[model samples]
Structures are given as C-alpha cells and as structure tokens.
Target chain A: MQWSTLIVFLLLFVLVTVLGFVAAHWRKADLNQLHEWGLGGRRFGTWVTWFLLGGDVYTAYTFIAVPALVFGAGALGFFAVPYTIIAYPIVFAVLPRLWYVAHKHNYVTGADFVRGRYDSPLLGLLVAITGILATMPYIALQLVGMEVVISALGFPMSGWAADLPLLTAFVILAAFTYTSGLRAPALIAIIKDSLVYITVIATVVIIPMQLGGFGKIFAAVPPAKVLLAAPVGQSLGMYSAFATLALGSALALFIYPHVLTGVLSAKNARTLTRNMAFLPAYTLVLGLLALLGFMALAAGVDKVPQYAPFFKQYANSFAVPALLMHSFPGWFVGVGFAAIVIGALVPAAIMSIAASNLWTRSIYRAYINPRCTEAQEASQAKLASLVVKFGALVFVLALPATYAIQFQLLGGIWIIQILPALVFGLYTRWFHRYALALGWLAGMTAGTAIAAHLKFAGSIYPLHVFGYAIPGYAALYSLILNIAVAAALTVLLRLLGVAGGQDQTTPGDYRAAVPDRDSGAGDGQMAAPPTL
Target chain B: MTTRQSSSGIHPRLWWRLLLLVPIIATLWVPWYNHLNPTFIGIPFLYWYLLMWVPLSAVCSAVVYFKTRDLV
Candidate 1:
C-alpha cells in the first residue's frame, strides 16, 4: 500500500470526523430536540444552503459514476450534465411555495404536508413508506462509493478492520448528525465541495496532459465503443435509455426527501429561490467529472485490481476514481479519494436523518401512538437514523454491485412519485385526497413493474421503459401514467362528492413568512443564523 | 402578476442557445465522431470531450444564470 497516500487520506478522514463532532457545539443549541438534531434548527442561510444542497444533489456517485459512464459509452453520459442544469429552474418555481406551506404548518416531513393537504393519513403513510424505502438504498449507494475508494487504497479489513471502516464512517456520521443534526453535513459539505472542486479542476488539466494530450487520448478509443458501439450483439437502445434517464432524473431531483430537507431547512423562501437560481454552477463540475469517463476509456483503465473489488470500471461510473489514481500525483490522489469518501458520508448522514424523520413523524407517531411527545419522537428518530444507516449498509453489502447502482436509480423513481403530493399540492388542493393515494399507488406499481421488465427482458421489445427496454425509462412512463391516473381519479372523486379534506392553511399560507403571523414579533427567524 | 424582460438577459439567452454549437464543434475532436476520416487536431474525439466539456459547461451555465436571474 502507498503509505504517503494513505497518510494523507487518514488525515482528511480524521479532520472530517472532528468537524462532524464539533458541528454539535458549532450551533450551541438545544441538542435534545428533533429540529436541532434532524433539521439543524431549521435555519441555514443561502451560502451554507448552497453547499449543503449542492453536496447532497451531487453525491460521491456523481463523482464516481458520471465519468465512468462517459468513459464507457461516449456522448450519452453527458445527459446528467443537462439534467442538473434544467433542474434548478424547475425547483425555483416550485420549492419556495413548498417551504412556505410546510413552514406555516410546522411540518417536519413531506408526509406531514401530504397528510394535512389532503386530510388522509393513509396517503401520508404511503409517502412515508416510499420515502423510507427510497432513501435507505440511496444512502447505501453513498457507502458503496466510500467502500470502493477505501478498498482501492488497499485498507485491510479482516473482522472489525474491514467492517470497522464502514462502521466507523457511519458512527462518526451518526454522532455528528445525532449531536448537531443537519449542521453536521452542512459543515462537512464545505470540505466535501472544496476537495471535489480542487480535485476535479486539477484532474481536468493534469490527466489529459499525462496521456499524450487531447488528440492522442481520443485516437486510442476503438470505433465500436463510440456513441454507436454495442458490446458484441448489443444494439443502440442505450441512447434512448440515456435520454429517458436524464428526463426522469431531472424531474425526480426536487422530490427526494433529502432535497426537501434542504429546502425546508432554509431560512426563507428567498434563500431557497436564490440558491436554486445559482445551484446550476455545480453542474459545471459534474460535466467535468463526466468527461473523466471518456478520459478513462482513452487511458485504457479497466478491471479493478483483485484486492480492490469495489474499484472496478464501468463507463460513466468508475471513471473518476480510476483516472485519478491512474493520472494524479499521490498526495492529490489522496485528497480526491478523501473527497469521494467524505462526500459519501455527508449525503449518507442527511438521507438517514430524512428517512428517520419520516419514520418518527409519519409512521411511528401516526400509527403506533397518537399521543407521542416531541421528545419521544425525537429519541425514536435518532435511533431510527442509526438503524436506517446500518440497514442501508446491509443492503449495499447483500446486493450485487450493479444491482445496487440500479437501486439508486430506483430511489429516484420512487421519490418522483411524490411530486403531485408535494409540488402540485403546494399550488392547489384541488386533487381529492383519495385521488392522490390512488395516483401514488399506480405510479409506484407501474414504475416498478416497467423497471423490472427492462432489467429482466431477454430480447427486443417495442420500447424500453425506465432503463428497462420496453419503451422509455420506467420512471418517465409510470410518472405520466401516474399523473394521468391522479388527474382522472381526482375528477371522478370530486364529482362523486368526495371532499379533499381540511386545508389547515389557505392560499395566503403559501405566501406566509412567519411561523405565527399574529405575533409580528422581531424574532430572529428570518435572519440568517451566525456561521458556526 | 407581471412578466419582466430585459435586453441584458437577451444576449445571455442567445449565448446559451448558441452554446450548443461549441460541443458540436468539440464533438469533432473525439475519434468516435470521425466516421468520415476519423481524426482532428491529432486527438481522437474522445480526448477532446474533456476539453470541450469545460467550455461547453460555461455556456450551459450562463444560460441557466440568464434564465433564472432576477430580471423582473
């Protein structure tokens, strides 16, 4: 093992852990509350919010996978770049309204919003279940990236040594997250984003020069592997899969529980709006990372060393890690690897918190006990967060690696189904509560089935649906079907005199700035919390 | 409700719309795009992808900025 590289890596890891623990005292707030532990006191300003959301949206997977795909497949991998660019405009128009409504009602999760909007606990339960299901695997995918990089550095894991790395990463993650809440990841995200920026910029310049310049690298790629290439008898449906994936992914970005957690944590709608407007800048880095895919292909880097099982190559996926180790100096490589490893922890921590909040507020509180105290709920949530992280680790360990990648994509699909309840419900409560439930069911069922068919099919079908080769990405098609079913059911239910339930807040609620308008007190709620 | 329009934004809009052209041009650098002769600038089209992405991203992001800025 490269001890110099290993030394640098350990230093970064220790630094991030220290930041995680210190983040608790950084806010110096009441650590006993759910808002403090889970949502970071629900008070991040635009700068921290930008880094937090940016770090969340651009995961270690984006750093690892996008370029890996580009390296393997060619032009198709660039789709993630455009999807991110377009995502902000969509979020800008929708999320502020959500923040307002959720804030006015003191809602903790999307399930809370859905439950109140449509007056249906059942619908809220479905949203909660889907959120927990989606987030668990998505969090695990972050660990997969960390495990890949850690294993690549040849970290020896016999019993606890092997398990200790992941266990340690998660425990440090949980400790800071448990102690500081949302602030933990927000603080560490500063390190994650800086390391990522430095590494990507350095590699963008360094790798091409090392490999005989731009001309020689492209010249090395075989014609068959270009945009039109297929592995042996494979066809060109991959392009369709790529396009559908971009579309589905963009639509899904805003609905994830983690995305909503970031939005709701903001100080105000203006902050959320401003951040969305500027967030696309991060995609420039993503585009650079995606290009590494092509670079890896050009460099002839494939097949991870046997000792490093997690570092194996697939186009657009493994490109960044492979190319960095292949091309960069050892110290810089250590920094880049730390960025990916730490990057994984930031999202993993937040995602677990988001999922845990759903378990606490929506599932346990609603179903198990109606009179649950806020302290009880907060305790349950903290425990749930730990369990969810470990559960995700187990899933990541049990599933085949490729299947795990598909699970994150599946996470995107499941989360997007909540759009009508969260995004659309922000605008109008016209859809009957029963209709929302029906739509969610239809979308989940159809999307999962289509995705299954795409994954399992033996030969050519009319259209590939949802990365499954039926027609389109299952997420896109099922979403359309879901929306249509939702609209149709809403009309039918309303026509039959089904009430949409009690909307506790009115149209004015979507524009409300304060938790309680009657006081008009000079509370510091609107002002940014001092940076810790 | 009001719609706001500004000319400063228009130039960025055009730049954004036109930015697509740079990648198309850069696509020529990768060898994969070279069906006719299979070479440009002595670098295959794939190698040029990294180069093209840096500039292309600038244009795409500029468009995003123009589209979302507080012009109103």
Candidate 2:
C-alpha cells in the first residue's frame, strides 16, 4: 500500500478534471449550438487537432493492451504497428475529403454525410446506428483500461469495492463531458499525450538498460513467438493474420465516429494533412510501447506479487501495469497509471460526443423531429452524450470485460462495412443506394458470424478461408465478401434501371481549398435538395 | 456528383495513383519477408520490415498530397 502512489494518482486526476471543466470556456464557442458543442466549433487548429486526434485514436487500450498482447503472444502484438502505419496513409487521403465535404455541408456525423450524399434517411440511419454500435464497446474498453490501472494501484479486488472506484471515475468524467462537450477532450488530450510520451520513453530506455538490452529481451521470449510463427511455405500461420489484421484495422480506423469527430473538428483540410505527416510519430511511440511487452516479459511481470494471483487466473492484459508498478518508484508508477486513466477520459469524451452527434443529426433531426431547431439539436446531443457514456458504463460495470473486448473485436469488422457507402460516396456517387445498404448488411452479418464462430475470443480469432487457416484478423476476410456482394448487387441494380438518389454535394465541394468559412453556428438544414 | 475530372492544377494523377500503390503492395501481403535473419538495430526482419513501412508510407502520402493538393 504505497500511499505516495495513491496520492500522486489522485492529484493528477484532480488536475485533469479541472482542465476538463475549464475546457468548456477554452475555445469560447457558443455552447447552445450543436456544431460548437459536438465539434468544438469545427475549427481546431493544427497542434490542437493533432493532440485531439492523437488522443482520440491512441486509447488507454494502446498503452494497456498492445504490450499485453505482445507479452502474451510475443510477435503477434507487433501487428498494431503495421495497422497504424497503413492507417495514416489512408488518413492522409480520406480525412481531407471528409473534412472538406463535412465542412462545406456543415455535416456533424458520418451518417449526416451519407444522408447528404444519398438523400436517403434509412441509409443515414444505418450509418448512424453502425457508428453508435461501434463506439459503445470502444468506450467500454476505455473503462476497462482505467479499471486495470486502478486495480494495479492497490484498490480492493472483485465485488462492489472495485466497481465503486470505476463508477466514481465515470461519474466525474460524465459531468465534465456533459458540460464541456468536444472541447473537454481536445484540451485534456495535450496533458494525456505528454504524459504518455514521457512514460513510454522513460520506460523503454530505462527498462532495457535494467534488463540488458533488446538482445536479451528477445532472448527472454520463446524463440518461436519471437519471430512470427510462419510455418514452412505458409505465411497464413502468422503473416496472413498479421497482414489481414493491419489492413482491416487501417480501413476501420477512420470510419469510427470518434476519429471522424476529431477530424471534422479541424479548421481546414491543411490541418489534416499536416497532422497526418507527423501523427506517425505516435505510431513510432506505439512501437516502443509494444516493446514494453518484451520488457514486461524480461521483468518477470507476470510473477509480480500482487498481480501473480490475478494473471494466474485471467489474461495477460495486466502485464504492462504490473511491469510499471514493479520497476518504477511509487510516484512514477502513479504517473504511469494516471497517464493511462486520464488517457481514457480524452477518448471517452470524444467518443460520447461523436456518438451523440450521430444521434442528434442523423437520427433525431433526420427522422424523429425533422423540424427541430439548432438549439434543440444541441440540447438533444447533450442528453445523448450522457446516455452514450452511461451505456458504456453499464457495459463495463455489469458485463465481463471479455465481452466488451469481444464486442470491440466485431467493432473493427462491423464498422468497415460502412466504408463503401461513406468513403466511396466521397469520390463518386455511382453505387446504387440499395446495393450499398445490402453490402453493409452482408458485411455485418458475414464478418460477425465468421469472427464469432471461431473460438479465439478477445483479439485473435483463427479464420478458415477456402483451404488455408488464417490465425487471426477475421475482418479482412469478411471485407472481401462485403465488397463482392455490393459490387455484384450494384451491377445487377444498374441493369435493372434502378436509379440512385440525388447527391447533395457538388464537384467544387470535394476540392474546396478553403471551405466557405461558415461561422458554422446555427447552420441550416440539408443543402437545398441538390438543385437537380 | 460532378462527373468532371480533376482539372490540371494537380500533378499527373497517375504518379499519385502509383505512389499510393507502394504501401498497399508493401504491407498488404507481408509473408515473403517474414524472417529473423536481417535484424534492423536489434529488431527482427518480421517486426522491423513492417515498422519501416510507417515512415515509408508517410513519405509516399506526403508526395501524393503535395502533388494533388491543388487539383481542381
């Protein structure tokens, strides 16, 4: 019971909560408007957008889980590196288009973009529903991250005592998010990123010195797991899973509503480009974070006194925290834990706002109350954000973390199904709307069914395709099925003379160097029906 | 939606198209280079080859962005 660690952790928590409350006033935008509340006025500058995005995409999960996976399975965890690497190039291409079009139309959610492109409320509803479902487990994973860190800090195990601390953290987090909206996460992100950078650098440099070097760290891991287990003449053993995991995650990364919320919050397309150029630095840091898994193995983290009992029973997710606690001094351990716990807040804040934005714009305003005013939409999103956060809370507190993680497993596969309708529509409005919907349905069903049927829960589910066995990353296999179904339906629908819906966006909208600089506040409804 | 082609303010779209292909090919099918002999600064071929793609892809995307940023 290191009191100093507890004291240090609480102090940092207090500081970030103050920052979260103060953030509502940071940008000084009109809280009464949905754009401002949900998107920070859609005007975050380069560094702020960088940090906000950095926070949104790199979750407490990265700090806790990446290394945990590496610690558990050795080389398999390194797939996160390739996933992020490929993701940014996609981000480089996708974000500017999304930002330009979203800004031009003042669209707040991806579903809003779909509705604008297709002029079909049902399609927009589908996108909104997928975005919301994808976000919930991700948010729950954040809670799981915080709980892991707190439990490492010597909180009571099991039962109500353990649940109380996580519940309290969420309640405080919910209050600030309800009040501050997007700005809360944007501001807190700076603090979170700095802490993570310092902690990762110090741990990587210091720990390797303590346990010889990379040579010894590799030596410590089993030789088979050290290099990915690619059997003779077959890459699918690990390579296929690795490639598919990276590709699937890269495709899915931008589609998450929270990631888009961060992107659309930026002031201009240039901000996204500049951010993309340097955001890879975080991926480099993530590489170091993955190495921490080896470091944890070197430190004999699973054998640590407090954690041995738990790890003996559960998965290796606690290895990273155990290593931090074992190696660092009490206060630094507090810093390490605090860094992760606060890291959770930033993404959790953005996720709820993103989910609520989908609710207000795509569902509530589009279907439930088409005549709702700007102020009404803002208020409705505020309430929806509350519900989104608590819904995640209910998921984390009531259900097993394994289920939350399993839900997130489908999240990658499930969310990518919407790529055709949302991303392709950015380039050309060619695919028939019904075909796109059916594609999403097929992708969702096939991806979920395949990933679920395979027994390997949590992250890696072995997939069987044709004759080869793909050890993990079931999403990409299903993505192929998804695209095939959509492409076939599209051609068939076209031959049948099925007409597509009118697209709301114009040619100029896609290449707008500087979108009309709308004061974005109180922006009007759905772009005048496309003037066909 | 605009059946109009991106007019000529941008560099050859072909180059950007080819540039984007670099990462897809390099990363999409990664089994061939899956080995442990050529360790880059103490990391294995399996791990380092993939991580090297991070910066390589960034540079490629940078070229594409600068080339096509002003396309009309």
lDDT per residue (tens digit) for residues B1-72 in model 1:
112222122323323334434443343222344232344555444334444454554555446445543321
- List model 1 lDDT by residue over A209-327, tens digit each: 88887667665766555553332333334544555666677788778888888888888877876675467668778876776776787776675463234443222345566677777
Give me the candidate number with maximum TM-score: 2
Q: What CA RMSD would candidate 1 show?
A: 7.1
The residue-by-residue lDDT of candidate 2 on A1-532, one tens digit each, is 4888999999999999999999989869789899989889887899999998889878866887777778877887787888888788778766787887887788888999898898888889999999988788789888888878887777777777977888889888888888988889888888899899889889988988888877787778888778776654432677767777778888988899999998888888878887776788888888888888888888897776767765753367788888887788999998988999998888998999999999999999988999998899999999998898878876565544433335455678778888998999888887888888888898888777776565325545666557656676667766777778888999999999987878887755665542332432322222322211
Could you tally the backbone clashes for each prediction? 40, 0
Cα lDDT computed for each candidate against the true fold: 0.71, 0.79
Chain B TM-score for each model? Answer: 0.42, 0.73
Residue B13's C-alpha lDDT in candidate 1? 32
Instruction: Please state the CAPRI-style docking class of candidate 2.
Output: acceptable
